[model samples]
Target: MDVIKKKHWWQSDQLKWSVIGLLGLLVGYLVVLMYVQGEYLFAIMTLILSSAGLYIFANRKTYAWRYVYPGLAGMGLFVLFPLVCTIAIAFTNYSSTNQLTFERAQQVLMDRSYQAGKTYNFGLYPTGDEWQLALTDGEMGKHYLSDAFSFGGEQKLQLKETDALPGGERANLRIITQNRLALNQITAVLPDESKVIMSSLRQFSGTRPLYTLADDGLLTNNQSGVKYRQITIAVIISRSTPTEAGVMKNSVLVIPLLSARKTLRASLPTKGSRSLFSLSSSGPWSFRSSLWC
Candidate 1:
């Protein structure tokens, strides 16, 4: 009979420590990245999990990892991450009135300040790597200008003073007005970058503030004559004006700051399916049979 010797857990100490070291490095890297990306909640969670993993592997008696690690990873990725994100989003003012961040709003205001009161009928002419605008003001004949597309800031076009249209063909240019929504949409497309504002091809009246923020943090709605005070960064408490008595009784509506009050309605089950509560950001809640009907 051949005698067999069993190797103790200490014999594999090298392998255990190696695995723990690797895990620590990974978790540390993730925590740093998350913290820098404005995800403090995630970074804290990673730190906690990494500490637990390290402790489990470092000890000889903690066989809990065989069951703990898989569950921890699953819950961290799915349940915990989503829960953290939801909590973070709940605290932000994301409504229409305060839609843009302070930084973005500042940029937009700066860009709007540079508009000149000049309108022109222009046609788009495609160049090799750029687009040229063939513009005519009243009966002032025609002028050609080439432009570079900028993500943010003013669209400053260089007047091709000496160069005329290719073959002098005026029909090649297509007249198009600048879309204001396109400038705002760029933030949605590339949120990390500065907001872009494209100069309009036609001159128009300037924009005015519908509401202004006071030094004490009160926002006054010029149109509705209502005033809103910021209770928290995410929540604003607004008092209704005398004129809005019919639509919004003596009620309060909690709304998302990034969204417009006029454009959204939400349905919630306060009691049961038989009784449905319909709510809008701008008005009082009502109980209805069906949200659609």
Candidate 2:
């Protein structure tokens, strides 16, 4: 039995190094899984594997401690340190709404711009990597044409029409026939550029990555003259419901608001028998579970 155990491949120095190398690869994979999914199970498993690796190395005394120390230190630094850091961040206002510092929030709010009742319906066509914009004033029914439209300092190709304009060759010819151009055809021209921007019920025509990121972290619009300072925008969900037989019923109304503020004060509904007195605010709020019995 002793002779057979001596002949085993694992007893060889090369096989021992190969086994250690494979275990190191497994540790790397576990670390990546923990990072991507933020799963605690992966972290726990990593610690178990690391402990086993350390035990095997110390017991065998085949490899030097230098390699073993680095692997154990790396597991502690990347895997365990991040887990502790995330738990610490959970207690703080690390979410989008309360993201920036007070000074940064003020700067972002001061830079916000809005144009009232100004609408531009755009027709976009693409050739190669560039896109053409045919801008039409919806109310005036006037179209403006340019040979090229520059975005991020790059010019888009503009196609010329053979026919004369109805208004004796105004600044540009108008394609007044509504729904004349098929959406699918426009999409085919700029398969990647053609997209709908849902600001509200009205879908506007535009391309995404519309803004270029400056080295200073500011976003500059490639088309319009608007410049926006980077800020954390929070999505707030407000739900109102009635209390029935000492239990709060399902939410009857839901309102979703995107803003940079922490507290949202909305008027409660007055029609219910039991009125909503006030909402108890909690950071990462937890609701009590109710029994149906």
Candidate 3:
């Protein structure tokens, strides 16, 4: 008697190798994409899926694994990993008190500074390839010039009685829309230790530092001579006040307000809440959890 032979899905070694090769290529593409975008976590998940698929197709003993590879890969890439990440993020403390990582916190605190320096009105002079910043200090009676490459230093401006305009005293600003030399804003320090900020095409001024951040984490305001520090505790308070300075008592923080104003503004409340304007004199306020007190 002759025995009958049945062909299985992975019976062809060529087809199995083809499938494995294709999965490997897909995983390689995903790895490159994720790495470029800084998504290292997702790249690892893709690598795991590729390994499982390659093992199932390349090994004859694991031929039966072909039937479940698609479902396994789908779950690992889409469902399981995302659900795990969501749960992990829920447990981590990322409120206001712990808003940034250690590195980012240090950078932010170091960059916290205010200007209280000399003021100089500026004019923009676009010269085809580059732009020129012309600064004038009326009180000091000086004129300075700077460009993209080098500071042109002080340039003599022959002032005449006719140069002075009437009441409006427009600052010789001529906007040539074709050149488009203006920037939205530029906050940078000059060689003279003065900060220059260009708010708009017509408005640019020089400033000096009025506040400095101390190593002890205090913000010293040079103008008012006030030292301010960040709030490190967790305090729950009424949302009536939105100022920076507030009183702290035990675990509760009392925000000081010179006066309280309540306006009847209409709003739609969430489910199981009172009408938007139904609150009494002790008005209702909205708040969310934060790291700051």
Candidate 4:
């Protein structure tokens, strides 16, 4: 009598190799993508985890661990990580002050520059095969020229205001569109250290930072000279659940974050400095964590 044999998923060596190769390529692509997005820490972590996972899945000796790893990774990434972050953030102002984090606020301030003084007009001038940038404050002002820059290809723009711009053969619509993205990244510094950036396709202007952050958690308004000092506020969490007799009021932590009044009008809660945790005023129960000055 002939006996029947069982067929397994990895019975074919070619299939196993193909799967492994595909997974390696996918992991490499994801790692490179994360790196390009400036998520260096996450990229490293992903690389390490992917290497270990591949090793465990491919090796017979660690076959048991292969089954365990997926669950553990899922629990770590999906459950534990979010739980930990949420718990940690509950003690602080994670979503306070118009839900703006410190880093995000800094980026907003950094990008809040405005054109000041005389603005310059920008256009591309031909330089052999490539193109050099030309900037002029007026028709007769000292024309600032930039070195020939290449974008939409291997090389990128590193334009300098020290470089001169002159009227000649201008770049066509095709070339301008090709280099438009790279042009946006270009910021040229003048001899006086003032920055000039392209505001539009044919417009270049002087730009100045509106705010700056200091080492000691101080945010300074460069235009108004207002300094915002970081301070801590106590979070009083009251569990309104009726236990055996009364509700439990648990005080978590003293959170330190943004608590400032800007000149611009916004739809945000009124700024308060009441952070002593000693609530002398009568108010309703609030779950919103405080980051008062």
Candidate 5:
């Protein structure tokens, strides 16, 4: 007869499965973030590898992976990832100035707002349970006031136009300057329907988005009314198949300081009997060529 051994409490199936599920969720979230950040290849690879890893760890029969897990992880992180990244980046049109994705480019253009109207000093005052804002310049031009509104846990405050401040109350210049960060978030609308944004510590002025994005991916300058076209060029060479004098072309975009130039370069490479790769293209643009002799 032999003595029986009991499994430790830490080795319970419930705890193990819970940890595995959490890891799966975390990996899913990271993949989503990577996809959103224009890392499509990395995100897809991470999803495939992580899902396989989690599946192997969760299943009882794959316990043999425990012996090789450390080595596999080390190789994947230090060796495989770099190699995959280099291969993936080789096919993309990624450069220092042309790094922004379409969405990020739109966001950057949208954030640029130009001051349109007069810049004025502002005030913030508390009235009962809410706050009101008052705007005026040293010239004592037409004064502006806001409705009493209470906002919670917000870093920026947008002012709603009110006919008048009930008690005509205004905070001192010291108080207004002290809450400069809160003042920075405020935007007011003018009679002409233009927006007013914080220009400085306490000054507010009318503004409009510098660039306007269109449905067809065109960007127009609000001030100059000049339209900029959005051009997309895609070249995909998924496999290196044997070709009999076939042409492969890639479009090149050379954007100068004030203009954009696109040039197309095509190469007709013939596969000889000796499996020699006679690949050549015009200009200095380079692409990876593989020969499967």
Candidate 6:
């Protein structure tokens, strides 16, 4: 009498289920890549090659070591290589300064805007994707009436008189104006690839995107008849005035610069009063100083 025969590994239902599950995952991944990246051809080719390799390995009679080498090599290159690269970057000063790929950093720094006479305060109204100024103030309670203008839209309302004061604690509100002028409690929203100017109380219309990104970097404002181009490493003010404007006029500005060196000297204000300036070479840099009265 013959002993009970054992079934081959390929005949096992568990093995079949595992293979089917793997194939489903592969198909799902391919579908996502195709929809998100629009790289259907590449995804299809990769899926076909991987599935063929998997099927060959599963059905092969001889456990050839060469068959495993290809899959192992691919895993090392795609999975392990990126992890190693990320760890390496974490040690270097690769932040907003150098961390941005050459093109991205240049774009970010170049997009910065500064105005000389415009005073921007909080409180704005949003009509669809456009924006309108709802309130303006300078010298604490000294309020000014200004009309709402739609940013990135063609609607401009005349400044009507209003006597509304923002009910809240009084603070310097320096950083808020510098980065973004939040409207009421809503976060400031910049149009895609466009930057807005925070104004001072001088009633100066701030600079805006005159040239679209499609125009290279030439900016022109037909309303003011101003035209300018992107300058290399230059602090060109978007809005300029003949006289000193703000409270911090002619004060020392310790502007931070991006550097690749491990240790970097802090920046000192070349023209303004002594103020604390900070920077992070590898990440997003911070610059802070007391508002000079």
Better of 1 and 4 by TM-score: 4
| Clash list (residue pairs), candidate 3 | 96-291, 97-291, 116-208, 116-209, 116-210, 117-208
What's the lDDT for residue 128 in model 2?
Answer: 45
Q: Candidate 2 versus the native: TM-score?
A: 0.25
Report the number of the highest-TM-score candidate: 4
Candidate 5 C-alpha lDDT tens digits along 1-293: 99988989898888898899899899989998776554666788788778878877788898999678768877887898889878865655455534555555557667888877678777667888778766765574566666666543334334444554446466677766776666666666554455677787667887788887778666667876655544332211222333465654322222211111222222224333212222235433433233321
RMSD for each model, in Å, please?
Answer: 14.7, 17.1, 15.5, 18.1, 15.8, 18.1
Query: Candidates' TM-scores?
Result: 0.31, 0.25, 0.31, 0.39, 0.39, 0.30
lDDT of each: 0.48, 0.42, 0.49, 0.59, 0.59, 0.44
Give the per-residue lDDT of model 4 (tens digit) for 9-39.
7697789889999999999999887765535
lDDT of 1 by residue, 26-88 (tens): 898888877655466778877987787678767768886757886887798789889987876
lDDT of 5: 0.59
Q: How well is each residue in 1-293 modelled by candidate 3, as lDDT tens digits?
A: 99988888777778867877887887898787775454556777878877886787677799888998898888877899999767755654334434554445545545544444566665655555455556666787766655443223333232222222222222344542322333323444455555566534544464435546677665555665655454432222322334345422122121211111333222224432312222233322222223323
Off by over 4 Å in 4: 1-97, 152-168, 172-177, 189-195, 233-293
Question: Model 6 off-target regions past 4 Å?
Answer: 1-67, 93-108, 115-119, 124-132, 138-140, 147-293
> Please, what are the lDDT tens digits per residue for candidate 6 over residues 196-291?
233442233345433333366644444455544332333222322224434222211112233223222333335343233322222333332333
Q: Name the better of 4 and 6 by TM-score.
A: 4
Worst 10 residues of 3 by lDDT: 251-260
With a 3 Å backbone cut-off (N, CA, C), the pairs that clash in candidate 1 are 94-257, 94-258, 95-256, 95-257, 95-258
Cα error, candidate 2, residue 211 (Å) = 20
Clashes of 3: 6
